[model samples]
Target: MKGYADRKDLPRFIAVFGCLLAAAILLGYVEMLIPIQIPIQGVKLGLANGAVLLMLYLFDAPSAWLLSILRILLSGFLFSSLMTILYSLAGGIFSLLVMTLLKKLRIFGIPGVSMAGAIAHNIGQLAVAALVLRSVESLLFYLPVLLVSGVVTGLVIGVIVRELLPKLTFLNNGGYQL
Candidate 1:
């Protein structure tokens, strides 16, 4: 069995995770700078989610989960309400779950997998918002918009990952740790 002590790249994992965390935080901040808004309560392009999905492919579920939670918390502290943190958590977990399932099926190529994650992320966030607000209205109205944004962002990020994959040797060897 492969042991952590035997791996020369153990420090590399910590470095990568740290970098991923930084990237997520940066993305969250940049997202706040963008002017796009859904007028409705819980819709977003979720560009930062792209990073999370990419990490999922490079790393393991636990790493992706950690990244998501860290990103949500940091973003909440920086730009949103405590309540927003809950929505972010719901969306991140749901999206991660969707991507994990799709990765297992190997149905859609890498881009497809990313798109799937984005859509699920949107759905999950909307669901949580609806529940918390005690109104199905947002879920009903937000689904189509979120779905559309999810597909578009997913494809964009998918293309990026495809271009990036061949170049990153670390990701190529399943170098990610849980």
Candidate 2:
């Protein structure tokens, strides 16, 4: 398992995590500022996911997972409600798991992984919504819209990552560099 086993790796890990966390928070903030509204009640552009995808490619799975969780928590406190936090946790955790698994399989590029994550995120959030509302009808009603939005948002995030990756000299597959 790849991890922070060496003392020398700690600083790089902290630095990378800090940068990605800040980027994720900033993206989340920017997404909030945008007034575009979808028909769905809980769907947004998912711009912060770009940082998650970038971290996944630049670091190990744990780092990506950590960043995802931190982004959810910090962004939630800063810009969203408690309910939003719950939905975000469910969606973000599910999305990260799917993306990490897809990335490990190495059969898909960033777009594919991101799309899977986005779809999974919607499903996860819908599942929570269903539980909270105690209505299967709500899930049925939102499924199509959420799924479509998820794919579009995921593709956008993936494209951003693809464009940004080549220019990020600090990212090394073997390990992160400061």
Candidate 3:
């Protein structure tokens, strides 16, 4: 119940990890298939993040953290470039840290935590963008727009996880001690 996986739950933990990883990758592919375009590049629905959130809530921070990194690497190799990997790695790390903190605080529900995580993701990505461009001002100009997009997309993913969690009662309760 403490969310750490024990020997008895190790197999289940691995299974959950594998399943979440698959879901994240599949969601990333789905996101790629969707043709939602914004004026600024790199803005996304963050569909894959849903699985990472689920892992965080269902198990523990380390589980979610691992999922986030693996998802980025796999999705990057499967669907994008080295730059894409770097950007995603940055965003994913920032997003997971904030989300884990908020979740630990118990101050916000999934929606609020997710929204904050999304903003963090944008900030992280923008930091990388600034580094790549060697221009902080240019990336700063995109902050407001990126924040707005993060709010919208993060809420979408949050609402979805909220709805989806209830349906997974088996996983939530009886699946494992992990």
- Between prediction 1 and prediction 3, the one with superior TM-score is 3
Q: Give each model's whole-structure lDDT.
A: 0.75, 0.85, 0.85
RMSD of model 2, in Å?
2.6
Residue 115 lDDT in candidate 2: 91
lDDT of 1 by residue, 58-91 (tens): 7666777878888889878888898878878887
Candidate 1 TM-score over all chains jointly: 0.85
For candidate 2, the TM-score is: 0.91
lDDT of 2 by residue, 1-178 (tens): 1656565667777787898899999989998888876656868888889998888888778888889998999999988798899999999999999998998888888888899999999999999999999999999999999898889989888888877887774545354321
Q: After aligning candidate 2 to the native by TM-score, how far in Å is the CA of 124 from where it should be? A: 0.4
Instruction: List candidate 2 stretches off by more than 4 Å.
Output: 5-7, 173-178
What 10-residue stretch in candidate 1 is worst by lDDT?
Answer: 169-178
Q: After superposition, which runs of candidate 3 have C-alpha atoms over 4 Å from their true positions?
A: 1-5, 175-178
lDDT of 3 by residue, 1-178 (tens): 2544555777767887899899999999998887766658768888898998888777788888988999999989988999889999999999998999999898888888888899899999999989989998989799888999999998999988877776765664554221
